[model samples]
Target: MVFALGNCALSGQIPIWLQNCRKLQVLDLSWNHLNGSIPPWIGQMDNLFYLDFSNNSLTGEIPKSLTELKSLISGSSSSSNHTTALGIPLYVKRNQSANGLQYNQASSFPPSIYLSNNRINGTICPEIGQLKQLHVLDLSRNVITGSIPSSISDMGNLEVLDLSSNNLYGSIPASFNKLTFLSKFSVANNHLQGAIPTGGQFLSFPGSSFEGNPGLCGTIDSPCRAINNMGIQPAISSGSNSKFGRSSIFGITISVGVAIAVLVAIVMLKMSRRGVGDVVEDLDEETGRPHRLSEALGYSKLVLFQNSECKDLTVAELLKSTGNFNQANIIGCGGFGLVYKANLPNGVKAAVKRLSGDCGQMEREFQAEVEALSRAQHRNLVSLQGYCQHGNDRLLIYLYMENGSLDYWLHERVDGGSLLRWDTRLKIAQGAGHGLAYLHKEPNIIHRDIKTSNILLDEKFEAHLADFGLSRLLHPYDTHVTTDLVGTLGYIPPEYSQTLTATFKGDVYSFGVVLLELLTGRRPVEVCKGKNCRDLVSWVFQMKYEKREEEIFDSLIWNKNYEKQLLDVLGVACKCLDQDPRRRPSIDQVVLWLDGVGTEGTKE
Candidate 1:
């Protein structure tokens, strides 16, 4: 039997009559205005496997009886035909539905307990570990206090354990490293301290999982400092045993002398080579990369969106995955930072962009912009997985693109031009346009930088716009005014030099340069004729004026069959590169024009 009345706006305490439901398997009273402590008699139901009293005004300690549920402790499987046998419609919210739906069996739900977002107090019963089959245990957003029970490590099947936003204190149990199956873990916003346990699943958890605890250390950003003279004896008393004290003083003098000599020798050696001393202070000996130590040690922050695929990602694991951002793993570089290809422990690949600049003052603004970017999702845009801020370093994690950037295909590779057929190139242009159009919509996000290299291609050759919103995130500039310019030199709009501001039309102008690259096999700025240099936009305009447009198309991709479509796209590109920003077409209009290029019976 299942009795679910979640979000029903029910009032007062839990009903006493619920005890009569002797065979109840699920009891959900979440998201109601219910108050008072949970009745201990509810645990008498041996068949109960799912219990939820979340989002309530409940007070008092978590009843120990709840941990003694026989069904959870013994891992008893529910009857497959329980719903059918009762002939009653049972509403359940499982993987199939976020809202409650009629289910044929109560067994579909996991054996779990949710008592979060309440006023529950007191220590968690250590016997909670007895529920060996419980898959989730959320006690977050509460006033719960006391150290976490070490016995929780015995919960072999536990997957999600959230105890965040609580008043809990003390060090995390080192034995928790034994929970190999634990995947999602968080103790954030607590009073926890000491070195975070390493090994097993703990190594996979990101620093965000331990954020808000100022006392925590031993992670990649927060290296633990060794305690000096940890167990050494105090100074010897002088009143008694002068001979013994002298003996002790002689021994201590000899030890101190030898230690001072060793230190002097090390200092002298370091002084002999300043580079060696610098490397020792800043670089990790294992990875030979800069260490993640921050000036404000415990305050380094990392935020991973819940939708991120790398839920178990950690800074340490990311370093290990990318060989400490090794130069050999570098896939791309731009005005922002170097992008390294990271092969995560779970077999998922990602692009780790180590952002450049002093981000100490822009922490709040940077986090806000990144959070907004995380919410902006589109099929043709590279997803922002997460971000980390340690010292002056800022890193943004993105979904890895398999085929690399369009710039590599157009100019870097010797034979890359031949591989991108006319149809494929047109497809990439349309996809990038759609992504830009979406960004220009409500809550108006202007991609201050757009170029061939910023456009990434996936396994299917579909284009995904990358580095969007980063120009504003990293640089201290606004839409209306700026002292410094941000964007590739070749892609900067003419109006930007005068107005010193970024706009949607400026983005369109940059996209036009990318379109020119796709149409004509040339860099945005390249040497034209004998020792003369010109931008692609001006050269294209000059060729059009002289009626030499045919000579402007890439010799490798130009074909008699694609002449009409190529000419139509060239017209669109010219409009986007208009000298006046106001004359340039909006991204939406550009998308419509690109969509029409190959749809009018044009062949590849």
Candidate 2:
């Protein structure tokens, strides 16, 4: 009943809470920057069945206790919280080797082991042979050196043996013939030197598992032929025999024999779907390139991120914080959700965004929105601390913004100039500009609804852009065509009135209107000439071009001494309102302009 924590940028040592999961059965914490040695105490969790802790920076000797666990899956795991610890992810169980191989029948726990993907360097403790109930042994992707202990043959119930991606050196033990229960085996990317097992389950695996081991000659792809003149090409038919049978409730083994007793088996399971080697190419975000990787050797199984999926807050914990959505606690309301301030258990401050009433098939939309926005991790953008998805309800938890929102800073009375200083305003503007620009780049994240209301501020007036409900994830294959009007009036690009979709140009158009709001202290929509202009766009167009550039300033913001600088900033804003979407500057271009790049026309 365990869930995965998936991939995260988390680093540092493993948390204490993980090793002491008394009621826990499954734990996963993989694909992170976690460092340090594996904690030995985790081996005490007797109830665990699936454990993963891989792709980390952990170092030290592999604990002998790991082999004691009776049931363990072959995968990766490690919590994704970065710190300066000397140890981190390494999921192992009590090894039943010579040190503690003395089996106490009274200790009838069903836990498994998973302690690969670390900096651990040492020999496989021969004591590992004592665990009679061991089902899966994975010592892959590590620095564990030395020969494979022949005692491993005692694992009569072992189904998977992955010693791939390691520095283990030695001949494949002849004792592997005793592992009749083995399947899904791999020993790829290692420095092992010797002959792979010939008969029994050893011949079922493909050639990829033995690729890097130069000295190892196998029945599978090597200059050296199989022992006893057997073929080197792997046999596909061996795994189809009685070894992988499933027992039926009626005391019959449902393998090829039993199925043949009924009717002939029609077809074999697709080979590629259940990978025995490298299957597909994937892009690594950090490297910005493609790398070969297998989908998984097993089902939607254990990975590293599952560890955080634990310690999650409950629906009740959320409901109590906002006082059941009381009006006094409410900060703002949006199209698809409402924001509320809440004080939760342990004095944690949180802002909860509750989604609008359930839209039947919108779960994918909800998931997409959360996943997209959650990926943006920067100091300028508001941090999404956590989230909750209960049945029909969707809630997002954000780190509290202390300075309230930009809407208040603008519209609310700046009674004393102290409330919103000129220096702070400039800083806020620069920060907002940078955040918006990042959203416009490759795999461009379009913040479809960018307005002052969505511009939030924290203590010290550090601006953080928030509210990404209408965000879109743009990629190369995207046609960028959609029939939906986004953004507040005036902020919407004039070009968008016809296109009815979002684009980087539309964002620039909106940013221009926001800039105008800063200059003129006017709402996007206001009255002019006894006719409602509907928004600022139409009015600003008139003031800037109709021999009236100086008039477009909010009086308080327009100190006579700063006149030239103000006009220069406003001119940049004016160009952003280009009638043609393509003419608008990109976010990076906007930043350079703000930084005084190509400013001949901006100065007097």
Candidate 3:
């Protein structure tokens, strides 16, 4: 049996009558206004393996009796029997619907306990680690105090464990490295101290998992100081009155100072030889003019991929080709920086993105973009040719698209509306969908910003998704991740304002806005005086509701002969723009629907 009433806005404490349903296997009451403490009787439910009471006003300490859950302590064999006998249809909803699961299949759901985002307090009971079959345990964003229970390492089957944004102190259990199956772990924004455990699954976790805990160290960026097993730094006594000790310390300090001065002098000599202190204006014999060489590119290598056509490319040649990234060579502007067109010495062309902003912020964007582009390789995705880190400047090289971005064609060019025929527009949508589908596959990647400006067009007008500076990696088990709200204004999903979370569904919403731009030949946000100003999404919905769907098409490409095809695509776009993210279809589904439209059009 299962009962899920999440996001229902229900008030008051959890009903006591729930104890009467002894056979219940799943109970979800999250995202509600329910108050008061969790009932102790809840631990008496022997068959319960999935319990979620997150995002509530619940208070009081967690009942220690929770460790006695029979199904979670042993296995789901008993719950499987009940599910087989009742054949209940259970639906799990975590921001999105799970499309009802049959009783037999429902037993396959991972055992979990969620009590995050609450006011619950009290140290975690060490005895609660008896749930050996539990797969997920989350108790984040609460006032829970005290150290993490070291006994939790015994839960061998655990996959995810989150304890962020709590007052928990003390060192993490070194034995946690024994959890071989653990895939995700976090204790961020807590009072935790001591060196983080190493080896096993801990090696797979990112540094973000241990953030906000300054007392903790041992990460690549934050190395731990020399300390004993008890985590205390050793200090020398200053009360010594011996003359021999004073002389020894003074001699060692002088030797260390002399060594540092010698090392600085040696480094300075090397820098001078590498052209850091002098600017050499070497003239190109063929051009009869001096070649431009940026001082920032001193001794910096221009790393290029094996597939790059520009062989023997150097940082000096790259600077000379773009005239040191002059304004005249700038081809476009992106959220991060300007895009300069580089005419390589080898007769090949490439686009160089010179990232702007503070060094720290630009460094993050540079790394994010490089990491994303390196992993995602599809026919419809832009290719990253190379990159360079020259002093404070960061540069990314890419294959220059001859036709430029879709935004320039759709909105900037006067004849763009007439040039992009209905068939070409349909093809662009299909290609973009396929590219997005690939990114949403195994080891999913979310393009936080999706708009026409980020979609480039090749010589053949094929769409290639670009600008991954705001992209993020999302594992299969993760539903969503909280991040700073970043995206183009008109393309941002409505739910982002409240949730501040990015998901695959959010990308679909932004793509829907792009589709509207294609069909209407209008910008996402129309600028006008008085009451005439309105966004394209609102305008499209108003027209559809008023039985004026035919009027929403771009007049330049609209043809009565292709009305059926246009309306079919319009329906697909409408589904993508569903107000509730759960109702929106996945990118894979969108690809199939689009292919169906194209197939039908061909047959006719």
Which has the greatest TM-score? 3
- Model 1 accuracy (lDDT, Cα): 0.74
Q: Can you give the TM-score per candidate against the true fold?
A: 0.49, 0.47, 0.53
The local lDDT score (0 to 100) that residue 133 gets in candidate 1 is 64
TM-score, candidate number 1: 0.49
Per-residue accuracy of model 3 over 4-120 as CA lDDT, tens digit each: 787789999999999999878778898898999988899899888889899889999988888888777866333334322224434444433222222223333567999999899
lDDT of 2 by residue, 1-604 (tens): 2423535578778788776456344565666678887777766655455566766687888776665543332211132111112122222223322111111111111233566666778888987877655565677778888878898887666766888887777777888877765655777877776667776656545676678766777553344534467534322222436233334313433364577655522321331122223212211112212211112212111111111221234445556678766656777666566688978775767788877543521343455556556567666777766555443455677767887877666764334223665556666777888888877764478887778778888878888888777678878666364634445544667766566667777788788877777777665753111222324677777876687877778767767776766777787787788888778777777766766622353422
lDDT of 1 by residue, 1-604 (tens): 6788888889999999999987788788888899999899877787787798988899998999998887777654343222222245455443222344443345445567998889999988899889876778889989999999998999876777899999999888989887755757999999998778886667657677899987788675565654474522112334575435777878977998999899968954653343332121222222234554333333233456667777766666766778766666878765445678999898889998776532422443355446547646898889887776554666778889999989878866556789998899999999999988887774467777799888999999999988753444222334443423446657888887666677888889999999999999777754211112235788889889999989889988799899989998998999999999888898888888899886762222
Q: Clashes in candidate 3: how many?
A: 0
Candidate 2's error at 218, in angstroms?
A: 67
lDDT of each: 0.74, 0.60, 0.77
Which number leads on lDDT? Answer: 3
- Candidate 2 or 1, higher lDDT: 1
Worst 10 residues of 3 by lDDT: 276-285
